[model samples]
Target: MNLKKSYIAAIMVAALLLGGVGAYFGVQLAQSQDSTAQQGGNGGTFADLSEEEQQELIGSSQGNEKLAKVNKAFNLIKDSYLEDVEDSKLIEGAIQGMMDSLEDPYSVYMDQETVEEFNHSIESSFEGIGAEVSMVEGKVTVIAPIKDSPAEEAGLKPNDQILKVDGESVEGLDLYDAVSKIRGEQGSKVTLEINRPGVSDPLNIELTRDDIPLETVYSDTKEVNGKTAGIIEITSFSEGTAKRFDEELAKLEDKGIDGLVIDVRGNPGGLFTAVEDILKNFIPKDTPYVQIEDRNGEKSRYFSEIDEKKGYPINVLIDEGSASASEILAGAMKEAGDAELVGTTSFGKGTVQQAIPMGDGSTIKMTLFKWLTPEGNWIHEKGIDPTIEVKQPDYFYTNPLQVEEPLQLNQNNDQVKNAQIMLNGLGYEPGNKDGLYDQKTANAVKSFQSDNNLDSDGKIDEQTANKLQADIVEKIREGNNDKQKEKALEVLFQ
Candidate 1:
């Protein structure tokens, strides 16, 4: 039989099986008819097929035995089942089963409700706790909380393993189902039981869901040793992220910053278009940013068209939370020699998925291609390791109780000793690394705070301690055992 004839014959078999069920199935057949019309006279209508012709088509497609088995099963369920089943439910289940058989996690069937939620997510406004989560190691793990979001306010941290949602265990649950349990109408309360890395006991955090307004680009200027550097943090590449990034970079340029740091530390990737647009700012025109390779070995390259490159030393910070479009941007920048990547290995997710709308209001997100860097490296399942691997400070995993108490002038303990050591590491000159919060130590703290833009209170509060530890880690990462802000500044000055 001709290929077109065989294809139409297959659809006819499906329509005939579902036609007697409901009006929805009838509508589906009508849509198929419309498609057949568009295809022209490859084969005549179902009415034109004689009984022998129909049997022949069905036999060619599935053989008589397999088709008989399917028909028998359908009739058995419909006639002998204890409960009445809806035709829509059966059709949906069959579709889901087909998708499940592929065994690809990224490819799935989205019902109408799921489609709406997916659209809302891309639009960047949703009623939720405002955290990007994913299934990691068989648990729902928080990638990051959006800046100024309810999740951030509730103290949700990166790599937090969510054990329960609203008093119900989320173990073995789908990531989307867990997310649905956590998300609700605005002003609704949702409780999360979190198991952090160092904490022995699970911490239960209560948060009020709100309408999250996402801001993808956050930029500020920092003066290091009298040299200015622009620090831009991209949370996610939402709809307006590219424009926001350009505007922020322009402001930094107007300030005449000597260096730039692009921080995508906990950014779960968003739209590819946003990442492409941002690449145009720093990559020279005609430079290939990324390549997409399809199943048939056809490849397409996405290139940059910016007239000029930014004349500044660039550093990119990424962690395990950086994925998808974030990896694309990072890979492009590193391949183009436009920036040096810092931090740890990034989250590997190089596959591309396209959401295709069905005739109904549903959608099917199918993995269509795999992305590669400009240098032709496929970073899927294997993340991109940074040039400089800077591990997070040990203090990051410490219990909040250990660091929450403010160390004052009269306090002398292990916490104070730790702070003094960090301060001395950063060249704060706190006299001694002894466990003593003396007047000299207090004076050193005040001086350090004055230079670092913190309040000159001469007390080691939570914020002060956190900053001190971060500065110490940064100093070590810069290859300086005892200095603040040396590596990037040296590169910029050179």
Candidate 2:
């Protein structure tokens, strides 16, 4: 498939990201949705229905008396409205109105262009900041930043409200329109004004858009207690994820590792069957890994064929950023596999959605089912809590300093206070982070300046502040100081 690499996703998705924005996952979980609109085996690519197909849809739509009133209103608006309006626009608007009435964020109407982008082959690369974002409560909110992407590097966090893109307010813009503004050519810079939770002021995050790779599984080895422990980090589930996971885990097993740790932090999720395949490696056939409930309230359970679990203990890492299919994996590991979960909590998204093509190039991705964990727990809005909760270091959540002016001795303000916090976190140890720059704070600043090869002046300037933030971000990314990761690895053997 010579599909163009999509630039944006719901977060280029898990649609494989609505920028590559947030969780627009593909559904192979329920094959019934794909049973419709079939065209030559590309998984639900049906369009321009035959006579029989059109009749099937119309027969289902017939005998709805309220639709007559809706049709009457549509005609009245078309014939008697004060201004000229295109019929296509009116129809699309009507459909959008219906979607809004449903009040489901994941259930969205995709136009032809968006539909094409949304269905972009999972095997392709992605471009953008690489965070899954959605319109939440009238504001475009970050669902989760893709691992190793520019969005993650720039510190974009889940639930972060994006107020503007490059100074333009996004108050009235829809998600796609806002995503268009956020997406850019690789190497181009985009500035996002973010209104994050618990922050007094909006943050200005500048990122250089880049290509997000298609690879979803990352493997490594951690030596814990003089024993080699395998660590598999699942950034997202995609078409090739399960195979990669299997190959990697087999290699780890070949090495005779004592235990295993699967990390799914900040994973917005991808294809359903992809996660299902991965679960088959851990979840036994005796119990169902996940259960799906349709609109009819009928339940269907899915189980793995494996009769026994792994030889060693296992632990899964999760946080508020871990969502959708990620939740499914974590839930299975916690319940079915009897593995401990480390980290704060999982992102509570237990619904199943499918993008059914409208036969007119457009598509409607609707939430069709509610997914429950193996124990039949519906964790919709309430996320799954970790068995052993752990948080990252304080510096990981430190506020980004927007120091317009230099901070010198005796200056009392937030800028000074923020710099002190950063310096303390970086091991400089400034006396009292009280938003006041004392002589000791100045010394700490001078020490940081000297270490970074800047002028050893006892003042926090623009260059100095930027360097501090960069270094802090680097430290946060290092995982050397990450407490959650430390706990996750330690719990593997304990």
Candidate 3:
């Protein structure tokens, strides 16, 4: 992001004023978190109001008629309960119920402990599986895993419902509680029983939690067909991201790259200002890069100060994992900057949320605005479209082959089908993926085993399945066949 003091301040003022929530875009929060624009956060509100204003608001709130029924219930529960209940607990439960009534997963209430954990995860990093999650339909659903984090490394996909953490059911638990269970000491093993969509049985995925790092930008250059393309992968938008992006971009430009590919495939998003700063680099001054709409439908259009677009082609890589600020950037680039987006549809998240602190340590994160693209299109629930839709190889989507019993010839089952998919992805074509363990599939399994230096048996045993999964994961990590990226380069030079 381009963080010129004057420009960043201007944008911050717009966000705070439109947010209409007390300066929850508080200076400390903005400075500390760079005003993260992710889907969730600790509290940032109640930081700017003066003592007099706070007293006035509190005094007025006490006499609010809208809360008459609520107060009556609160008093009844407090006075005539069979068993004693903590006043604080009842009050917090009320707050959480109100948030639940909104029916929006992004809005939530976090207590001090949760707030501190959330803040820690954003500020530096934390020891956990490293995935952004939400309470969707009463289930703790993964929004997306952080790039290169344990959650991603463990094959946790977007929308995977975490049914159990460490063999204990997380059903009926709030998003915070479920996530707390998922997090543990660094290097400790945590097993997640995941209810993946379309799978008949839940899979137990064991992951070793590690310290998730804070760095977001990764840069490299790819030489393809005589043209060098600069590739910048933005894992998330956070403090100093714009500066880092600028520095890396300059280095790429210095090397005389012919084209550029901006990869935000698994980026879950960060601060609004962080993305806004990055937009200024590519989007021309003539068009509004993003438009923020408030509760009353008041719109604030934000534009860059740049005179023109870059000379070389710009291609953005997006997939199901790109969200929020990532979507904001993708929308702006495709519509206003004319950058070609090469990948599948993105994760749709269009609302902007700001956290408001309660007098106590807890805070309420409320969705305050709906952001639209430069073309006045709201991609909430409906993702931004790619100019050239390119899908990765099937291996990228293949799940781990679970082999409880040896999958040998003549066996036909879902497990066998899954194994066939993996074998096919490994280039040992299993002839068909219809769940039939035919002679050809057995041959493929034997070939794969031999290649991995295992016994040349034509059966997919536990060891063979593990080896197959490990090799496929390693190939994916190496990106030996990233079809989407190849398409981006193809479009860049076309």
Predicted model with the maximum lDDT: 2
lDDT digits (tens) for residues 334-378 of candidate 2 = 999989999987778888775655667876666766778889999
lDDT of 3: 0.74
Model 2 scores a C-alpha lDDT of 0.75
Maximum-TM-score candidate: 2
Candidate 2 stretches with Cα past 4 Å from truth are: 1-23, 32-55, 58-63, 120-123, 411-414
- Residues 360-431 of candidate 1 have per-residue lDDT tens digits of 677555556677888889998787888766665433233222455678887877667767777776667788
State in Å the error of residue 201, model 2. Answer: 1.1
By summed lDDT, the worst window of 10 consecutive residues in model 2 runs over 36-45
Give TM per candidate: 0.67, 0.90, 0.89
Clashing pairs in 1: none
Better of 1 and 3 by TM-score: 3
Candidate 1: worst-modelled 10 consecutive residues by lDDT? 1-10
Ranking by lDDT: 2, 3, 1
